[model samples]
Target: MEIDYASHFSALAHPQRLSVLRMLLRRYPDAVPAGEVAQALNVKSNTLSAYLAALRAAGFVTQERDGTSLRYAASPAGLSALFDGFLRECCQGRPDLCRGIGGDLQTKKGTDMPFRVLFLCTGNSARSIFAECLLRAIGGDRFEVHSAGTRPASQLNPLAVRMLAEKGHETDGLRAKHMSEYQNDAKAGFDFVFTVCDRAANEECPAWPGQPISGHWSTPDPVAVHGTEAERMLAFQTAYGMLQNRISAFVSLPLETLDNLALQHAVDDIARKD
Candidate 1:
């Protein structure tokens, strides 16, 4: 029987497992300790162990025993197999088009020129909250970023706060603010307005003087999900990973070099990521 690479890849089909892959990919060759991985995903040690085991069995990951800790990294052959497998079978011999799409995915602007970004979603709880935190963490002082919601929730999602805090980013004073707060103001306003959930993107937005660039990220509602504590935490972490990938690319673009049209395209790309 031919080996179904799809089945192997399917092992990483869970939200948390894929998150672990991207997180490990970002830290490749560095071997992040298991404890850190657990913390990053807001998962318990046992839960993380199970997820890691699945990934290892799928050949997507490897572990190195570091004294009292087991650090994890992506397996070279595993990743290549994954890339080749996906590209060969699904891409329909147009790998170049796929590559082009990836290239156009999201490019970061140079660190020299910073842009103020506002992340919007229907509820200020989960997805939008994560996007705001991730962008600031990845961009540092390079970009001014904030988050808001159309129908603002009562608070920031606790899981989101905890997850970002584990990554060394402070979430103090990160309350859920309403989009209307910035909607009518004559302030300088956001250079980019991003809606991270489908509902927010579809709703009418408040007018701004400059009508800052806008885009829709369409992330799933993590707060509405029901599962075991570990499973729920994993959902938030997965969303974080997705937001981080886009933000990483966004922070690397040469925003100073791009004219309005290019910048608009760039922002659009950032908001369109899966």
Candidate 2:
């Protein structure tokens, strides 16, 4: 099929249209309801519909009837064709520009551009916060990690902050934040997003940009354990240990070699560790 390169570019030219594409890519294989998409981007229903229509007309998006509402997803074939065509035309005479296009794009960019990761939970007071700090320490400059809650606590859990500090991780900059801060902003693209609590894992999430690989690591909420100070601290310690092990495993993965599906499976497998 002859790809309409100009139409695809034009469709992607608008900021809102590009935001729609990014959201669609984040939910790539899964079709998201139009209403959900609109809510995530904070775009008005009428405006969102117009943007989606343009994407659909450009062959960049595909829609399927899901009961009464339509669900939309990025067209992988169309996107692949569009990008390949763009690169080919741009590099037609510049062989040097095409030399390092294959393999993992992450590695190709090297560690100068850190991989962005976000951890999510219901409260943002414990598990998610711990994972964020742990991964940041382990991955260092290789990762830019952040954590948030669906319904965030007013502040970081005292136990969590102390536990991380005792272990020599910086807790100064860590604070509980709402997940909504990351949503609706197209520029806040994440490379990977993990939900550390069961509740947040099950809840509907905003569409993230960059098609971030996502997984659930169900760690027990330490705050729920009400006991003596020592016992409560032990619970926090246990949660910390679990996250440390998982983050260790995560950092050791050959991310530069694995494809997206393989990388996703690797991430899911980490959750199975005790």
Candidate 3:
């Protein structure tokens, strides 16, 4: 059945539903519990129930049962569909008028721009930074890499820096960056955007531009460890190790030639690596 875009849009027509989608995006690649969503929005459970139902119905969000509770994750396909459907109908033949908007959502495929990849997480401090440094060292000139946080820390995590330096990766110029910095960088949209959030963080992940191939590479939050100095260093080391493994596997793929669906599968497989 053809979706009634005009009517379905009513799902997000309200401010609360839109905010709910934005909140889920922060934890993209991970699901947020319904209760937590309510807490975060400061809405009563009953009210949030209506908001979530509307989003799910409109395809902005999806929910799954975990035990007896419900967890929600933002649906990328829904947003992509909304954009594509709207443009197809709205811009019909006048591609010139919507050219920039359409182009903004495209990957740098069939171009010599190298693979523009972004690593996202709650904080650009640890797992993401580790991935950035590893890819820079491993992928060489075949990839252009950057990392940013949904809620960036004021500075890069000291433990992360120390661990990277000890591993012989360049830690200079490494700092936490907000995802917003990339908004104005239109011409440099990413081909791949990975979320490295742990399972527990109630994070707000980035709304990646250009429909980049995305997957979740969940790593433990080393920054959350509060223990003896030795134990804390161990946490950073563990997180770094997982990202190193994942990025190393990622750099091995023949990414440039893979079709869109293949690229998506490749990244999803990389996320499952040890």
Candidate 4:
């Protein structure tokens, strides 16, 4: 069947619309909920609905009936069709023009190189940091863990730090950082990247290289909780517990035994599992 390349290009004309597509592609093979996409893009439900509809109409995105809610993901064929068409008709078989389209997606991990992993949250002060520490403690020699925020707070949250200390984790290396510190993974990206909060889940992630598998393990924002000191700490405790459970299961996975698609589904299922 002939694909309408013009319609697909036109649909991505709007910047936000284009962003939605890119973000979805980053989470390819794993669809995101419509509301989560809106939250990530900071768009009103109606506005995002229009953007998604255009993408959907152009066959650039796909919509699935996930229970009662709608989920969106980049269509597997949409961009590929565009590229094949561009090379055949526009670039006239210039393979160099297609170099930027795909990348080496293999995991080149070895005994000498630890399997790199990254965790993300918006503020970086709490959840992502918590995850970095947890994975570091649990993953041992097989993993090298990192965490960052989309919009990092100036310092690590005192409460988050205190709680970790109470649990006996060293606090010296826990600094708030932006994701860009690990940017341009086009040559070598993390083996896995998980967004632990809803905000970060929606936020546009870095262009991961080498087929980094991604998952959304949405934990409640401890900082967003506005309550008494004790109650607030409880939020941190709960978030920490949830993340601990998920990360334990994650590090326990037989990663070496699973292929990329299986690993993708495994990590994605980690979200729903806990």
Candidate 5:
């Protein structure tokens, strides 16, 4: 089959269009509602429709009708074709370079070293806890993830723990701790420090030892939501989904290639989407 790499590249040229593709990739094999995608990207419905249409035309994403609204997911075949075509063109007649292409691509640059990440919030019970757990579940081998709060909770939130358990995430070693613990410890440092709530982002934080790149991913406090048992559970689930989406985007980044300034911009861009 003939492939038009130019069209595919053109389709992905727009930043918003690329973001839509990444969002779909995160939920690959599972279609997400168009409205949800738009909400996550903070794009106008009309604008997002246009972006999706471009992706569909390029064969990067597939859309299916689920009752009234459309659902979208990444097309594995299209992605494979795009990548394979690039490699074939770039590595032609270079057997040695092509031999370890797959292995080298996955572990390229600084991926060998464990990246330490810290999630911070006003209270470590909910948002930060969920971020810590989700990142560990997704990128534990590559990242040493931790969470802390300015004012630590006495214990982990039961709802948070239950959500993690339901999602098949480990909760055995998880507990609330004060940010001061990491701050005062000379050896404690992080590659990235993320503030998951507005309160924490506004508050003055300790000067991290390594001067790690920092960004704010503001999420509503699920614990603060007052509602019925079902409603409360729903709140927790919503928060979990938000963090999962953000972390999925985080894990997908080509961290080894992006410098600190570029990495900081990328982190800030991810937060702006939500």
Candidate 6:
């Protein structure tokens, strides 16, 4: 269904509406009840009801009567329109520019030439590990991704391993690796080196042979939390959720248009969640 773009955006302009949309995005294809969404976000039922009504009227959500209540789910066409609009506007009218940054959302077959990416952090534990597993799972066959730490850890953080498993990704072969493992190694230099730690981002990095484009994510260390096991796990989940969100945006980038600096700037803008 064709939707009024203005109405759709207007409905999303409010903070609550956007938050609700994000909550739905996190549960795509799963129709969540109005009460459940309200409770999860701590919004008053009536206030959230109004937001949902606006969203439904704007075609951002679809509502179905499920027994005693209604369930709201994402309208893919609506979301595509919204994000596609974003891609066009922010990318300066060039959708292909997304490929230059690292997007491999769903690479075409026979076009699986692997791009090299290195995920870095201070301890090679949580954030970097999440990036590696996430990229491998979602980056199509277009990437050969590795995660390493500026200061290597003797073992992988167990929480990171557990979280990855919970996310339906295999953690069998994952281990904490040293940044030195690939730095200056003729065979494995990266095409993109993303530092997930403040320390790693500021520190002098090993000279990448290809002079990989670099960026900093600066995620807080989840393993450093002094808390009960449940609290620490919650912290890890929070970090994982944040990383997952950023990675989804990063993977939407167009890596093929870097030769055009104008397009590169636009891609960069979209890649940074800040």
What does candidate 5's lDDT look like per residue over 130-175, in tens digits? 9998999898688888899988889988988988899898889889
Name the regions of candidate 6 deviating beyond 4 angstroms: 1-111, 260-271
lDDT of 6 by residue, 126-244 (tens): 89999898888888677899999988889988878987898899888888888878876776356677777555654545467764655556567898887899999988988887777
Residues 1-274 of candidate 1 have per-residue lDDT tens digits of: 2346767878777988887777665343446788877776688999889999998988889988978878897675686676666676767757564452222112334434457788888778778878887888778877778888889988887887887788787788788988877776665566777767655643444465555655556567778779898998888887878878877877887765666557556766565555
Where in model 3 is the C-alpha error above 4 Å? 2-6, 76-112, 149-154, 177-189, 198-216, 260-262, 268-274
Against the reference, the lDDT scores of all candidates come to: 0.72, 0.80, 0.78, 0.82, 0.79, 0.73
Best candidate, TM-score-wise? 4
What are the clash counts of all predictions, listed in order? 7, 0, 4, 0, 0, 12
Q: TM-score each candidate.
A: 0.57, 0.61, 0.73, 0.74, 0.60, 0.57
- What would the per-residue lDDT of candidate 2 be over residues 149-239, giving only the tens digit for each residue? 9999999888888888888888777888999888765664877888887567546566786667787777888999998999999999999
Q: What is the C-alpha RMSD of each candidate to the true structure, in Å?
A: 13.3, 8.4, 4.4, 4.5, 10.9, 12.4
Q: Which digits, one per residue and each the tens of the lDDT, describe model 3 over residues 187-231?
A: 647777777874323454445666777777888899899999999
lDDT tens readout by residue for model 4, 120-209: 888999999999999988888888889998999999999999999999887897899988888864546788888887667666554676
Report the number of the highest-lDDT candidate: 4
> What lDDT score goes with residue 194 in model 4?
85
In candidate 5, list every pair of residues with a backbone clash.
Answer: none
**Stretches > 4 Å off in candidate 2:** 1-111, 186-188
Model with the higher lDDT, candidate 1 or 6: 6
What is the alpha-carbon RMSD of candidate 1 to the true structure? Answer: 13.3
Q: Identify the superior model by lDDT, candidate 4 or candidate 5.
A: 4
